[model samples]
Target: MSPPKLVFYVTVVVFAGVVIFTRDLLYLVRTETRYGQLDQYDHAVRNKHHMDQANLKILRAKAGLVHDENNIELNLTLRFQVNGGENEVRQKLKYVDKTVKTSKKEAASQGEITFETPSLLTLFTTWSGKGDVNARTHNFTLRNWARLKPEVNPVLFIDDGYDATVAQRLGWKTHRIPKSSINGLPVLKDMFKVIKDTYKSTFYGYANSDILFTSNLVETLVHVYYDSFYSDNTTLVTGMRTNIVNLTEEEFSTQTTLLNAVSTRGQLYMTSAEDYFIYAAEYSWSDMPEFVVGLIAYDNWLVLNSRYREDHVIDASRTVTAAHHTVREPDYQSHFRENAQYNKVLFRKMMQFHVEPPYEKGFTNCIDKYTEFVDKKIEIRSRKLEDPCLF
Candidate 1:
């Protein structure tokens, strides 16, 4: 009934519909394959930053202090370095009143910084080479932090495995907190109280122990942590978006469907209880790191509870947190062997290594792994240092 031109137009429209329909059907098949949604997420996380690399000793909780009958102002260091090479290279250090700074670029790499205040909040690594770095902003809370001296430590926390002579010989102070925590929460609470009482503030960073600094991670964190640029009203900081890390709106809807089945939050720990739930690591069993979703939920809660923007970031780089809970050769041989070989990597790369318990007395301990990883990285960089583009 239509003219020739009209008929041609209709044919064009119908063909377009078929093509779009076919394309969508293909996409549906691809997304539902065994790899499914997670494959896409892996690529997103891996690209955040090249492998790389905070001292703000401030906490402002209403908690009291040890000095005052005192809550707990403390020096917190996560012993993370496993020195397995030649002899121990103890470098010279310079100490200022409230500030413990190294004389040279690498001086702080293998030294300790002590805050005499009963309350100090810091995220320092166990290994000297791990690097103590924080922005000058955090140091604003220090009292005369720039008094110069050699090897100054008021007191240090000693674990069951610390080299006792090092702190003693250094003329530093040391007090040990015997127990560790789930997600470092217990130790941190004490540390938080210690700092808060001294500083009369409650600024805290529940950060990773492996976070070493070649550059100032503290500076970057302060910039990002307080900057209002990336966020808007009613939004939360999820940091970098990782693959499969953030569920789609639909996946979230289904997660809700499954979440309701749990009677208690702790019951959600078992994957069998619900695949949607992931429980705490041994140390985190009680308080837990809060699930990715829960972290976001907490952000919302924090936003609601206070007018302040307590931005929490889940994404940093491998250098910031290469692996959580050490992954061993056996693990690599099994879980990640074919990761790169796949057309689409199946699992999202893990960020931090959870320290496995029942400590082993060997060079291959978890601390050793981090040092080895760092050394290898340094070696690789040294080789490429000549390239003008690298600088």
Candidate 2:
């Protein structure tokens, strides 16, 4: 009886040991399988990330961007069609990670690539220092121009014995007028010629001293700088102004306040009266007439001449806010000033030489191209003008 009991107990103990061994073996297999699955998932995720990064690099390269591996920055290399279409500009830009995700979409939708950056431009002006209102308005506009600093270089053209202390202190370069009319008014052509000789900038411009510009001026120029329309041809950029009546220096103490006033209190001036003129540096002023500044006919004639030369003219009225403060009404008496009539005579003479009918050219309505915002992006579009004259 004792031998049989020993045998049964030995069999039960061996079966129990087998059972425990099999359970441990199954547990080891399940753990190995779980770890293998996790490893496969990690490899797939890493592969996807690598592929995305590679695609981003390819897209950036196609968009004229070179990525810096160490700093994660991008450098832009642009080929401009200025001065005979052979110039290249290289600029470094700070990169953002989100740019990688949207670059492809933007390139696809815009039909052209654009980058936001400060552009180099030169602006000049001449004003009389005769009245308190004139001084105040000039100071306000000059200060507004200051906000475009480090990007736009402003020059003040003064006649002999004119005070330029404020403009100099505000970082504007002061230059004596190269030539003036018999009445001591600066000649428009001479001012432009001096600017071309003195400054090296992507674009050059002249504005009435009372007109205030926002950063949109710089941004618009940057857009025009990259557009294919102006790539191969010299471009003349002009725009209408917003007339703000009795605007004071205190009304535009800050940029926000100024923009608010422009939107809420200002009225768009007639397109016939353009307050500013921006043109590429390549534009030629060789045959420009000796029309005087602060006069009406010169502005219109400048546009006419640019068009007659077959250069591109863009009306940037939609994108640029040129605020003109009406510190005082234009003197009707001054319209008959000898210097003022000088401009009109010059314009008529120019029209006669060009063999074009009078009153057919030299207005904002004659511009054949314009800059407009499409989906918050600047785009160049062709404008159809009625009664358009052939240059």
Candidate 3:
């Protein structure tokens, strides 16, 4: 080859190498800086300066205030006259963004950041009884959950006497679960079948109407599915929830905004495992009781039944944020009425006698942390079925 031609080729190769090296260096620097900022924020939380009452107000407002059981509410006001005023408030809120971003990055690294689930998820909710805030809040919640995995197909099963139009407007595959005065609510097991028969997705989730899910749910679900790490087809994943009273329509526009608000204003309280249930579509749970969902102990019954069947019940609190929106009073009160109370007694009886199922062997439980489940059939301990710890 000619010397001039050889020189030209060498120069081109050197330029390409330089560009690649520069790009990689910049990426490394950005990653390190982000991690460092995250560490700094965590350290700042522990600093003595953070404990000052003046600074405490700002932190409480940004992180959310929870009243003690004694009804003493934590005063969280951003209107305090700090030295920097609005600019300081802005920085406080900005820290929330950093905290959330840091959390996302850590979670992504843990799960290896796969954006899609191997198979489409078909998630559904059952709703009955209503107030004005019901549809608006639920629509917002459903859409937010859907965006977590755009591949998911959502279904809404409205019981008799409930409006289906609102759900249809939100793009859910709407259907009516038949109600009967004789048996009361529709059969829970049959409803599950209906959802599976209607939508042909690989996985199915049944959540209560008021429950709201964050993006972490589907991400964790997908991660569990991608590697077949949770359990076999019979596995059920559930989690603890955070409760927020009086959520408005304005906060529903963006997931980040709602989540940050939840982090700041919401009270973290976990109810029974019945609030959420996710499992493979092919799961065949037999002889679910005629006890309707709204009945006091029905949700608990579902958990016990899963245990009886020896199915894997995973507590996914580490990755899921189940947000409950409590906006009305009477609506929440009717849940503890006469019929529901009776059902609770019945549930306790069943548990005491071990009358139902007669399956002596208990199911394996994976609670709190996420781990890849191998095929070894390892013995997992049984946690207290009703115990809900703060996330």
TM-score top scorer: 2
TM of each candidate vs. truth: 0.27, 0.67, 0.58
Task: Please give, for residues 147-265, the per-residue lDDT of candidate 1 as tens digits.
Answer: 10111112234354445464445443334543343322124335333322333211223322311111112212222222332222222211111112221233223212212211111
Model 3, 1-391: lDDT tens digits are 9999999999999999898778667755664664465446544543423366776555533322321222121121111122333212211111011111223234333422322222246777676644434666666666765554334567776665677665566667777774432235554666777877776655787777778765445444544554333454677776555667787776666656566556565554423334777887667756665555655556656666766566666666444567778775224453655465545555546653332321111211224233221221111223443211211
**What does candidate 2's lDDT look like per residue over 96-195, in tens digits?**
2221223323542333233322336789998665554477677787788877764678899986567889888898989988887857788887888888
Q: Which candidate tops lDDT?
A: 2
Sort by TM-score, best first: 2, 3, 1
Q: Candidates sorted by lDDT, descending order?
A: 2, 3, 1
Model 2 clash pairs are none
Which parts of model 3 are misplaced by more than 4 Å? Answer: 1-119, 129-133, 145-149, 179-183, 271-273, 328-335, 345-391
Q: Report the Cα lDDT for candidate 1.
A: 0.23
Question: lDDT of each prediction vs. the true structure?
Answer: 0.23, 0.66, 0.52
Question: Which run of 10 residues does model 3 get worst, by summed lDDT?
Answer: 90-99
